[model samples]
Target: MYTSFFLLSSRWSLPMMMSISHRGTGVAMSLGVSLFGLSALVLPGHFADYLDLIRSLSLGPVLIYSAKFALAFPLSFHTWNGIRHLAWDMGKGFKIPQVYQSGVLVLVLTVLSSVGIAAM
Candidate 1:
């Protein structure tokens, strides 16, 4: 079963993979943001206190930047893919070639925007 699953997944085309990724990232971002907001509401300290706690860890700049990139990537991907989805909803870009082209465009835009946000 596992072998078959892996084989099937490996055979996914770019658009298929991007569609799956869009749903996965949407779920992840929703959960992450919800948990974060809930934590802020229930935590015993101000937001700056948590910020200070993280700062106290003294993690290196590289690690911090990597963390930022990790967080930004899903958000960027979801946002771009969502735009694609909206276009699809409007009866646009339904052709196979157009679908593939839009998928690639979304990926490129996602990467660029994610990196830009992470750099800050």
Candidate 2:
């Protein structure tokens, strides 16, 4: 059974992959936010102090933008995919084609929004 699972893994559909990604991203964001929040409260310095420290490094704009995009992509993907899930709950987009289209739509929107945000 386990061997079959691995052999068939490559055949997983987009919807299947997206469903797994959605759950994974949810867990990742939850852990990240929790850790970041705890650090903000428990650490000796203010959030702005941390910001100042990062600024002191004087990283180039390309690296800074890349970092911002990396941070933004997960949140963006999760948010858009979440809305897609909500539509599913409402009994819309149940057809196979609709499912794949919605998944692609979510990816496009995630990229565009993440880029727009990181550009700021």
Candidate 3:
């Protein structure tokens, strides 16, 4: 019926995947931030209490760092890809080569930025 769509790795190009990911990350972050804010408002204690509960878990350093990276990843990716989209909006980087280059650049920067933020 062709009512559904999928992104097969070999079928979709880099820019196509990045565009899809950008939209997905944007929606995810928006929903996540909204829920977090709502939760904070509805929950009993202050934000520090929530932070204390998590810290008291004593999750090892590796796990803590991994969790930080997981939290940072979407924000990093969306920010870099949003910049790429802005460039596109300006009628720049429309060439196929430039598109691929920017896509790769965005991914690299996302990972690097995420890791850097996570390290802190």
For model 1, give the 10-residue run with minimal summed lDDT.
Answer: 7-16
Which sections of candidate 3 miss by over 4 Å?
Answer: 1-10
- Shift of residue 106 alpha carbon in model 3, Å: 0.4
lDDT of 2 by residue, 34-109 (tens): 9999998899978998999999999999999999999999999999999999999999999999999999999999
Which pairs, if any, clash in model 3?
none
Query: Model 1 over residues 1-120: C-alpha lDDT tens digits?
Result: 999889878867998889789889989999999999999999998999989999999999999999999999999999999999999999999999999999999999999999999999
Cα lDDT of model 3 by residue, 57-111, tens digit: 9899999999999999999999999999899999999999999999999999999
Q: Give TM-scores for every candidate, taking all chains together and pairing residue i with residue i.
A: 0.87, 0.90, 0.89
TM-score of decoy 1: 0.87
Best by lDDT: 2
Q: Positional deviation of 31 in candidate 1, in angstroms?
A: 0.7
Candidate 1 lDDT? 0.94
Residue-pair clashes per prediction, in order, are: 0, 0, 0
Q: Which ten residues in a row have the lowest lDDT in candidate 2?
A: 7-16
Among these predictions, the greatest TM-score belongs to 2
Q: Which stretches of candidate 2 lie over 4 Å from their true place?
A: 1-10
